[model samples]
Target: MYWSVDEVDATPYFSKTMSRNRFQIIWKFLHYNDNANLDVNDKMYKVRPVLDYIVEKFKQMYQPDKNICIDEGMMLWRGRLSFRVYNPQKPVKYGIKSYILCDSATGYCFNMRPYFGEGSSLPDTMFSLLDRLSGHGYTLYMDNFYNSVALCERLLEAQTNVCGTLRKNRGEPQVIRDLVKTDLGIGDKVVRHNDKVMVVAWQDKRLVKMVTTCHQDGMQKVDVWQKGHKDKVAQFKPECVVAYKSHMNGVDKLDQNISYYPFIRRSLNWSKKFVAYLFQMCMFNAYILYRARNPGGCNTLLKFICSVVKSWTLKVHERKGSELGEQVEEEEGAGVEDGDLEDVKHTLRAPYNTDPESRLDGDLGRHKLCYLKPTSKKLRPTKRCRVCIRRGTRRETKMMCKVCCVPLHAGQCYIDYHTTVRYSVSVQG
Candidate 1:
């Protein structure tokens, strides 16, 4: 979802045609139903209203502030169909993408851009977002991906201060103090990794450079005498000539946060897929809230309650049947016959009932096909099955599936199902 300052003020009421709450409910539904997708006509009225409300509320919360942080994440979709406007990435092969601008100072979200593929196009995408900001004097803290001379110059031109990681071999480092060439040790040295700052100079312009002015935030230079003439602590404090490296060295951690989710469903022009994303987000939000509220409480209990309530609320009515009953005519307009009547009775299968003649008989040379089982089965059962024995009644005993923990019969318990459910319970229960 996206919101602008002007849109926040206008506060448009979501039309009644949108059935589900646009902000919370639709996404919540999409979130929990792993197999479900969102369509374009999916009820978005409910979510739109809530989103409208949230924007209004946030505006009130930050009435005088307009500072925002800009970033983008791609939501991948892997399906047979896709939108002409939003094409999938060649390598990624599927999924939509979205860029979000959040308020860094106050954790409030402000803008979103749903697209097909931009996750891999970081530099260009960041430039586009900066253009949107349009000369706003905002302090944009970014990672190494946005750490380039060209990007920094563009941001500086736009009056935006980009404080991000420095490329390893691209620019000069910021020097706080100087070191004697002879005193410098070869290779690397052992030092305690703690919250301590070191004064080092940019050795190679090709190795370390910044687009910022060299003008002083503040600069101090201390005279250095022979090493034995000075205090040993001073050597470490004023001139700890450590190797200069980028601040954001943990690329793996950052990469993990830049993956796909449901928000990009609309990029594919599929409302069902998008709704599924929103639903998942809401569920994730709910789970986090519940965990925060009740540290040791049963997540299964909470989830079960939600499922029951959702099932009860969503009506699944069966249509009444009135077309031809068991009566059968011998031929077109001819009188009905006993044989034809029996055949008609056989054809009229009732709901929740199976045809009795479809069953196989062993006397007809048919038996359950028995194939040799593999020496090992990969799936395991879940711990919720154990609850069956403890509860003694099936009423409150819905076991988590061993594979997906999406609730399954306990009789077909496998090792794979067991481990999968146990892990899910531990991480998400």
Candidate 2:
């Protein structure tokens, strides 16, 4: 639609701001890590840097309320990937699956980890995601996928509370499991409890099983539209059920917010699509933080994103103008006669420093390692290694990063220069 010629489908703003070819070029080069430095054991190494950075930023920017929830989120990807999951229940049925921990009230994501495979146990994954919140008095709500009797007991030991729908086979009390088999009428419920856990089997339209470490066996009245009733009528529900219903939609809310104006697009590379999904998540998180700071601010997510885009686009235009002016001046200076420049002592400017993050982005441009050309009539060409010079050591190498134009030693030094934010080396004697 952005490139549509039809009057109804055309979005002039996208075309005016950036041409389709420019957008495609940017998309094609969008990357977060050097392919050469990827860890073979880690499936998400291609986008691990951005993924970890965003997750850490998400946690640091905000503290979630006591009432938080855990749920699965899906990033739509049709491309082939080893860990892609399929679930008809999710809005994006087939995609990469992620376990997300979110604030129940505001739907702010606290932490998220993409599912790798069967190698990671459920308990281990849960504990890893809740590492920061464990030992705090937070109440975590989840579905059957994560809630289990043993897990609830473990969380209670960690001083955290758990409440969610439970599967029959997930170590539920035998009494509760038997109760699930029993036939019951509307609003009928059976409850069983120990010192640390409570299990409930309630029959409304169907049998609902739940386990909780925080809620009681008490019932709460809620409005429900029955089969024969013209208007809604009051129905007795377990307190746990009511609480679960209220808080379990945190991940869902996050998904809904990003779904409206998603940054993700069709891509042959699943990692690219995943990175775009992460970017969308970061934008939503920023919106959440913005709203929190300025409660009275009326800027919606779309408006906030548009304002950001406008500011960035203006900066780009300014940068282009400055670069063009510099080029013109350089051309005029080159045309000056040698006698005219002889009176002026010109100091060579330092090399322009490129962003380190951009260096690691694995862009499509040629970035191969090649031998430096000899400046003098020497048999072998050698330049000071960029990594070694930074380490207070004077080491030279013939090999250099072709795109960066900076010499670096082969193997570890080359990988470190592209992969690490800070490359360290011990000075040799």
Candidate 3:
């Protein structure tokens, strides 16, 4: 059905007419899962083709700005999947986790990797992400999970600067952690570093720790609305902490943009769920590009989404074929008396009103011949066979006419039954 957003929203027709079937009966993926173990990640599954295609398009569609961010995001999935990750901090606590590399300023996602049970090589991912922006002097901001001394070093080697909160276990100097416990006043921060990178032990409310390959001992003053003072007092903070706070939400901001008008649907298949998320991401990235080029263009993303949906729903050619106003008025009420009514009646099909026996089995319908397997061997219905009815025998059979929804004897009986109505060939042969 051609679906306009207005029509879909105006009336809840799908639930009423189509029984709200979420999937087609014959739907099959081009790729199949070749996994020997159902417990591990199935990367070669059918959705892999579509997933690769979508991710490639997402990366090629946009060039991220100088300030990029590395972050992990969760696309919600409650299905019974082995690789589902639970991060308590995210807006969605339970989901499939993915690493996202995004533009800090514009929230344009350039690349992503799905987490598949393994604690994936974050440092390797960081270097690979900046490889796309090599020689561009981009700065990447991240949270503690993806941030490490090795990651920062690798990013620096790739000519991309890094800044983010770091865990104490990432092999930073012991003194750095000790400095935070010292009697440092509010807004006072200490830094220890060699020639390449700096680790800052900063104290504001409690102790805040950050590691960076991009900054010196420089400090910037900013107002903390809730954390610092009730009046939003300005306090000195290290430049690394300042930049990390400013740019850490690049992926999250993109999430916010797409999430406000999400297209996620409950699906049993993992690939289908991922594809829905990818579609949402693509539409949102397009919106971001649209606004950047046309600043004076539109209002909210919801309005834009509705317009796109409605546009796709419209058939331009069909509308253009419509007659002119003068022609329409001249032809109106000029048809034969019962012609339109007869045509409408002919077009509509009601189960009882329409002749069931005269109806063709359809061009695509299948009919086959097989031994009427015993009830103990097969799942087909066992009934007093229709084929034996004419022969005056009440022998039961396990075969059934699928289309006509009736049980019949197998073999020539099945062939004769379908050939009597309409079927292109004997499928069982």
Candidate 4:
């Protein structure tokens, strides 16, 4: 159960020549056999079957005491070399989009899919995760991107429950009448829904009527009035007539250590793509497996792994005076020795040994995180390779999330209050 890329890279078995900095390199070799001629897409296709293998392995490895909360997320991808896609509405760089299904309770990744270009069937972004789980009756949560009358109907057919943000301008129209005195509008038999909400204004005051499939949730019998909030007048606040189950997006789960291999990734043909995907899935699954071993801790499994890597990297320094070491020192000044370097290392360790405040507190999760912790340590050791330290600090170097490159622990990534409460319901394209 390794946590960081450094750990994965440090494994004695990997070829010495392999570049640990770019994880995609390792993935490329494992998936494509270090063959430059083979196509990347072809590798991805071959990797699909590995998913089935992972599913079997997952079932055998962990037997949950109870049904776990499963949530799905997707990443949009284009060709490897490019970052943008050709969407007239919003074009993005050519890259890969990944879809993931995570066990909310454990914050472990259960399944993942790497998408290339847009194609038919496209796994129905609305129901992609459901398709992967191969079961029903589960409560699925998503943003407005997955909202649709047809998809809702499908969920009903499967006996699965779903609660998501409603798409704007996609609701049934209501007829309301403005009566003599009150600005309130009366609708036809509106049922009582929410226990409390502010009424901003009335449309017609009288003859208020609304059509909605959600009427059964006990909202059909109350007065359906269009209320405006102080935030925005154009957008009306939703006033549910009945008490419906309020579904929220589960807390942010662990983040996967991912890398973008823009150049080589795009050149792959179908055959190579399949094979590469197989390797990608295997490695990602390995990442999830690693996280499962550690329940709660600072830094994610990915961060842990990277820490191990940094520690192991010290071993490279251990090989001082060796042929490779000499060349490294000559070619890269980072390997050069300095008298004060050791003193700096010792000073940093003193607090961990003598002072409690300097020690890691286990209460980071409770601090109400302001933003994902910075990837780079504000202060760095002067003796260590600045390049290596830079990798740890740079958003791109950490093969995890842009917000925080550290490896994932057992639970999902931390999210802010606004994102959890509001944006959780709305879907993204």
Candidate 5:
């Protein structure tokens, strides 16, 4: 719609701000890290700078509330990556995974860590995520994946509290485990406690087990609707269950807000897609801070994002428009003589010969062999092999070097053209 010419499909806001070609070119060449200085050990070295900077800024900008939550968020990717994860429960079933910590009240993300496969220890991951807020008396809520009885005790030692559903075998009290196996009716409850943490197994539709370091064992009355009853009825439930339900959606809320106006799109490169996800996170965090300072202001997330886009493109649009017009005028004014016209035509038809030293010095991977795509329905694209043409023999092929933009036959012709300084001599020999 950005570049559509039809009346109904055209979006003037997009067309006026930036041309589609320019946007694509920018996306194509976007880079964050220097290839020469990359750390071979780190899997995400390509985008580490931007990722680290964003994470630091997120923590520096805002302090989270007392009640906070941790959860896993997925960045949709199905490429051949070493650390990609699959979780059927997530809306994006296959993608790169990241652990995120967010404020329960405002849904602001404070920290995030990309999963580096089984090498990363769960306990260490939790401690790294909560490094800044460890001793601040804040409560952390999460799902069974991150909640273990040992982890809860560890957090309590750092003056932090944890409340979340626990896995059956995560060193919960044996008594609670036996209780879980027993058949119980709805709202039936069993509680066990040590000096530090409390384990509760409550029976709802099925058995639900949870561990908490900071919730009372007392029951609270809540209105719940049951089958065969039209009106809601009051039922006594565990206080920890209520608190867990209320506060365990911080990361989910953050994901929901980011999903509303996603900046990411389909891409072959996982690094680029991950970078776009980081940018979206930064935008969401900015929106949170914006709403915080201006509670009554006319700034919804959509409006804020639009304003940011407009501000970024306003100057670039005017400058690029003028530059394009000047270039067009120059092309129109210049005239080619009859003698030079053929040379111009040849230059347009064949690739200009590049410097041989630079072409042969680097890794062979730098030069890509690609099939010549057909430009028109009636014609198949072909070019005279540069090496064959030089050796007094004409050859045509549907294969070309992407970097050099010169056609060559696959075997000896392609190798000689890139490797030999005088490829014609090599062909003759």
Candidate 6:
């Protein structure tokens, strides 16, 4: 992630021209330590806690506005899984589907559900997701996939209002679904209401159908002023369209933010995409919280990500520098005329020998050792690089990520050794 701040591809960031220790250790830790427990049979078990943790954090950190929205997001993953969906309409034609619930005003995700495909119904999932944040008089803006007359009535009973575009065939009387163009024209609408729920259809290009329990059958008058003409034309629109236009795209906004250089490492694991999605949600939520307090601080998502990455990388360097200083101090104190102590130069075998957080322990998940160590060290040096020698700069270099047939500089020539993102170095070895 730090490298992504300055470099585009992973190869350029972790070049074979550099010592492979740092790159291999980081790569291994990033992939293997997810802080989750997973069973072989459960598809979502790997990322369930990740998503739950992010959502719970968002809920605790921010109080959403009165309006909320529900939408679907499909990530681009063609991995082997039982419930991988294929929706040609989505940006990713084949991947897992997530039903996202976000705050309409702030675009903060409150909850999400990954489709596991074993007897999971659409309405049931939507209701369960909304159940997390009900009773707040928060109005929901949803799409036809999760909307029906029956469901809206149920939500109304819980004091939550629902406004969404609905399918004509789902829970609608045959008389209403079979309306003709002669009965309704441009700027015309019809409504069917019971005690709590209402279904309205307004004519735009075609008939736009919406079901709601939170809104009234009100028409709003808007003035259409032609640019060249001075006359103000009066047009009428349904309250559903106006409200839908205002609040229904929160989930879309979240998806757009996540697609910006996401931290999804390429892996065969299907749950990697889900975990990456959760992490993306966490970052986006954090950005939202930041913006809520400082409105003008970070203008866009990309800018927020850049600032976060740079600050974190700087902190890591500062911490490492302190540790290095402490190590040097200890080495200097080794031969303090105590007569029992050995010489400092003999004890200081390596500059990097220090305490690291990467140690295996009883926690069992993230306990793997992550420190980097070289396998062999050549006692004697060889000739300088011929190019540098010709250039009168005699720079000597030697190291390799894999088994080496030729000596090469580990820094500048990193791009020369590994031309691809694939790494042959093993962190464990």
- The root-mean-square deviation over C-alpha atoms between each candidate and the true structure, in angstroms, is 22.3, 15.6, 12.8, 22.7, 14.5, 13.5
**lDDT of model 2 at position 194:** 86
TM-score, each model? 0.31, 0.71, 0.67, 0.38, 0.71, 0.69
Q: Worst 10-residue stretch by lDDT in candidate 6?
A: 366-375
Order the candidates by TM-score, highest first: 2, 5, 6, 3, 4, 1
- Residue 294 of model 5, lDDT score: 88
The model with the greater TM-score, 2 or 3, is 2
- Regions of candidate 3 where Cα sits further than 4 Å from its true position: 1-8, 12-41, 180-182, 226-230, 316-429
Query: Can you rank all candidates by lDDT, best first?
Result: 5, 2, 3, 6, 4, 1
Q: How many steric clashes between backbone atoms does each model show?
A: 45, 0, 1, 91, 0, 3
lDDT of 2 by residue, 1-429 (tens): 374343222486566457899998987888879987879889899999989999999999999989999899998877678888899998789989999999999889999999978587888888888978999899999999888999999989999999999987888877778764347877888888889998889997679999999887799999988789899998889999999999988998899999999888777988888888988888888889989998877478877887667776767667756664543333223323344332211211222333333457755244457665433355466768878888878999977665454568988778778776777654232
For 1-429, candidate 6 gives per-residue lDDT tens digits of: 354444323454333223588766755555433545557666666665666667677667877788999998887788777788899887879988888889888778888777778686776787777865676788999988888888887788778999999887888656679886677889888888888888888887688888888778999877776568789987787888788888998998888888885988777766655677677888899899898899989998878876786576566657756665543343232223333123322333223322122121224232211112222243333434422343356576543112111233554343323332222332223
- Give me the runs in candidate 1 sitting further than 4 Å from their true place: 1-68, 80-94, 117-124, 127-133, 166-271, 278-429
Q: Highest lDDT: which candidate? A: 5
Candidate 5 global Cα RMSD: 14.5
| Residue-level lDDT tens digits of model 3 in 332-355 | 233312333343233222322232
lDDT (C-alpha) at residue 355 in model 3: 27
Count backbone overlaps in model 1: 45
lDDT score of model 5? 0.82
Model 4 lDDT per residue over 251-311, tens place: 1333333333211253344435444444444444455565666656424544654455556
